[model samples]
Target: MRVTGLASGIDIDEQVKKMMAAKRVPMDKMSQNKQLLEWRRESYRELNSAIADFRYNKLDKFRLANATNVFSSTVTGNKTAVTAEATLTANQVDMKVRVEKLATQTTATSPALADSTTSKTKLSELGAVGNADGKVILEVSRGTGTPIKLEFSKDDTIQSVLSKINANTDAKLNASFDEASKKLIIKSKDYGADPFTLNGEFDTGIMKTKTPEGNLQIGEPAKVFINGKEHNPAQNEMTINGVKLAFLEESGNEESVITTRPDGNNLIGTIKNFVASYNNLINTLNSKVGEQKYKDFPPLTSEQREKMNEDDIKKWEAKAKSGTLKNDGIINGALLQMRSLLWDTSTKVGNKNLDLSSIGITTGEYTEKGKLYIDEEKLQQAINNNPDEIAAMFGGTKEKDGLFQRMYDRLLTPLTSISNKAGTSRYSADPTLSFNEQSIMGKELTDLNSRMAAFSKKLKTTEDSFYRQFNAMERAINKFNMQSASLANFAGQ
Candidate 1:
């Protein structure tokens, strides 16, 4: 703010700028440190995300498969008529089922009504056209329960009155008028005994409402014979001991045989996916932990960047960002632990090939780090020939755990550790920004920021003092020149 050297003929502004530039060196260095810290934080966060994905998305599925054991169900007989499914407990379960009856809901229809008794017709017109009672009563019940009664009467149109009934009626019955059928149709919500029994005194003479012989649908539950035992239910679907059966249609002639077999292909897919995911995660971790660091490539200062083109700056930053996570003990230690897990012996349950190698999952060359490679043919052959053995490896013995369970536990350890160190956005306790905090690096960044802030404040104060001193010098210089000029003028006169 101090203009320099109007009378002293010295460009004080330029000189002051040169002096302040020196003073700015410390602040600029702190800024560069902050930028480097930002890069380091970004690296840690990316690693954390990768680790979480590997553990939660990949390991979690295999862990579930190991715990429960994998199995799939298929129906062979009359598949078009009846499809069946099974869960893990239903492994190797085969059964013959006959669907005797499919549950159906009840429906009742009122006889043809006068032309004026449509949805748009007035509600009060019911008294004039139908019965003078002007009351539309419906009685409904489900199963063998007590009957629920409802009555509706409004000064609105017939459609409005019906909507009110449909909306408010506890009977769970839907009421509507079909113009094509020329009848008021009322259908039960679901199938069950005593589902619906509607007896109302509408002017039967004016609007003769009666059930068409076959139209009267008494609610009926599903009936099926499983293994030659008749089972009746109020629903069409049921799950018994992991075997889920749904009665699609009534089968009167031949019984449908549903067989539940072990799905080796699906299990193979699951295992393959697990292997691929492990490889991808390990490769990334190894690369990052071993990434080369270029110490010469310090973060660029604004002044240094001003001397170079954008492309050069970008190239410089690439080296600067490298090795942010290189040789990090936390990450490297975790990788070592995970790698060791691949070589460890799996559970020795039921005299099975308990090692990952026995199942066609093996690590690549040592140079590839701990990346796993799967032999599809060998894995499938094992699954087909030694299904029980495969099951035993995933599904542990009565005493010990299985291979997948072991891996899950191992992955969980490092995952939890990394999470605690470089937490997810939601869980980070000390974030880099003072406004945000995460566990480890966040605290460091926060302290660094505090120091830089204090230093910046001091720099500002020093710069202000410099300007003030320069301003005073300029004033004195200007006053001395004016006095000298006056003396010269008096001497010449």
Candidate 2:
């Protein structure tokens, strides 16, 4: 058995609840307005998204879908060779005069012992060179020892040439080679011979070097036009319509820096849009759930009035202050994702682990009372580190969720359900009718329109009765006043 919630003629809880409910009409209206604002925000977000997509795909012709292949290498030995794939826009390119060897080469080694002043050995004797197809025929000089004569078949590799030279002579000669760079320079076995000589010759791939080796290998530099301007990474420079960009090698994990200042104001536009959208959402939530100035409580509804109790109000207030709603799961989740993304990876150039907070996003403890807020400087730092990551955090499909979808469900679903149930139209009586009571397959519109006309007529009748009652009361008051004055005159007579 259950007791009635009412007590005597006045239920304190009910009366207080009625006051609360009366106060809450404003909240209900506020909720609708919030929904309207959210709808507007959504419209703007969609429009911006569409515009961005258009710019990236059609308008902004400078976007990079992919990057050109880059080549990097180093040569270790005196004679080295390197081969890599190449692609060029020009059908025919001038691939000559570019030296195959690196412009600058460096080597590090332990210092020679002080007691032993003997110089390190250097290789000197060099001869016969071959091309891509193996063929050997060349001349050599006997500088260190007796001049030696050697003969080898065309099928022999470059390695074979070195083997024959080492076997036939004791001139303190040594040879080492790297296959990557295709460089075959020789040195003397003695350290004092700073520059060893290679007097060799060959046909096809083999070219004679002017200094000592018969021929040096050189190729043309690769060139490209990016955004209608020439760019050569090997040259470490790019010229975009007379605006030159000198790219220094990336230091540490920092990205190679580039500048396009006057035209780079797009960042400002993007940030403004984000702020507008986020503020719109925040404002909507505030309007709906803000505390009342008079009682320091949020407005309640009719159903809430019926159920209000001291204990219940306290509990519900506690829930509002302490639970997910107060903390705002959507906002908290968005921020968390952003923070997680900022700290996810290391710098590309250097293996330095990073976090948003490191760059500037400083996050503190979050609570249900909406105390947590974004640190703009820290957020900007994180964005500077990785713009793509930040964008994805706010609007990515990784989780298949967003604030719009979540908030819409939370605030709209219950109201929609109530609206459907409270509808007095015949459309609501149909079991097959959807909760919204609007569909091509349903007769809901016809029923609702007819019901609305009847309700309007009844409202007019009630208004007319109120006016007639007011007129009647006015006439009675006037008649009583006139009769009172007549009685006073007769008494005086």
Candidate 3:
């Protein structure tokens, strides 16, 4: 602390502080500009996130065939014999179905063992023969796949063997021990006519079973009759004309009938959900573009913030950040493109040109700015009269034509533009990774940072110069006072 102002009778520290404040004006403005740029970048990222949610979650799925076609089926007569499920493209017809037989799995059971037998019983206790190393190996094979060899010591328990068998992926067999009956049962994991074989000493010695040619109980395939024509499948389930039928039991002489039809309520609900999401997204974008800007509310400087309360600072920033994305060219372009796609009627449903208005969807008033409104009654009538046409309209048979597909395709351009301007990492889901620094806004921020740093260094040098000048003036005044005092004393003397 250079104690100045005493010699010159002037407050040197206060004067220098005033001058420095004036010199810092440019630096303060730079800081404010940088803050505004950061806020704008944040706003762009938020908007990108919202658009992505709508595109991937709603539009992407709505353009698929199964999503647009909503249909259901009901089974009448002998419901216990079979159950049916229908997809969107299922034909609306009543078909007679008879389940002649249900599929079964291949299984084998060993004879009753000693009363003391348990899952933990050792292989030696079960009188199993082993190799010279006392390792009892079992070979199990299913279908035409390579056999799985399970090796166990004679001291190994029955539970251990069963666990090894169940854990083997190649064997695909389920092994269990019935403690009550004192019998070991092996069954194939899949239900089919194909047979699995069990070989090796563990099977012959402990199980006391004959060779694979005589001992196995093979599985049987299911037999069913649809419209007086027989169909045999390895499994009990079959799908015909988009209708999946699962046979649960055999129908002796009775036949079950499956009926399918269009579900208007479900289709309406799906469309309503889509409409809600679209409106929500567009509403947010519109609000952002129309948000009012407060020119007087520039970002506060650090020194300014120190003098104000937290609440006041927050309120000030709210106004300052309001118009970061207002009237943005990219966002406005996206909105126009989306509205145009919705209004276009170039695609056709059957022989008639397909349009939102034809199926009860229409835009709101001009002031509302492309908001969609649906007439539910008219939509239901359209669905009931020509459901296929409605499906084709939303989910086009070919790509690039349907309403959802067109919207999805059009959104890519604006999304890409925003991403390029704001910058985004490929791993967007990972919050730890920041936005790419090579983007347009990123490069501008970098340049601004460099300029601010250079200006700050210049300001520091200027402040030091002012302090040096003030000290020099104080030293000169002190020397002059000393000389005057000495001269006056000599004269008086």
Task: Give me the runs in candidate 3 sitting further than 4 Å from their true place.
Answer: 1-3, 108-145, 148-189, 200-215, 345-351, 398-401, 425-433, 488-493
**TM-score of each candidate structure, all chains considered together:** 0.75, 0.23, 0.85
| Model 1 misplaced stretches (Cα beyond 4 Å) | 7-9, 55-74, 91-93, 105-218, 238-242, 333-349, 386-423, 426-450
| Residue range 1-493, candidate 1, lDDT tens digits | 5557776677877876788898888888878888887787677767766776776666667766433445566777677557776654565657788887887777776666666556787645655332356656555545577766655553566677567668864668777888776667777776656355554543232233343422455778888888888887777877765677888888778788887766577678777787788788878888888999999999998889999999999999999999888988878887887767667755444665467787788887888887788888887777666565676566545566656667666656665665555544423323342323666656777888998889888887987887778778878988998999999999999
Instruction: Point out where model 2 deviates above 4 Å.
Output: 1-273, 291-377, 380-493
User: Which 10-residue span in candidate 3 carries the lowest summed lDDT?
Assistant: 424-433
- The true-versus-predicted C-alpha distance at residue 423 of model 1, in Å, is 5.4
Best by the TM-score measure: 3
- lDDT measured at residue 63 in model 1 versus the true structure, 0 to 100: 63
Q: Residue 450 deviation, candidate 3, in Å? A: 2.9
By lDDT, the better pick of 1 and 3 is 3
Best of the candidates, lDDT: 3
lDDT for model 2 comes to 0.36
Count of clashes, each model = 9, 30, 0
Per-residue error for 139 in candidate 1, Å, reads: 7.7
In candidate 3, what are the lDDT values of residues 148-237, reduced to their tens digit? 888988998999989988998878889899889888988888787778777888878765457442346788889899988999888889
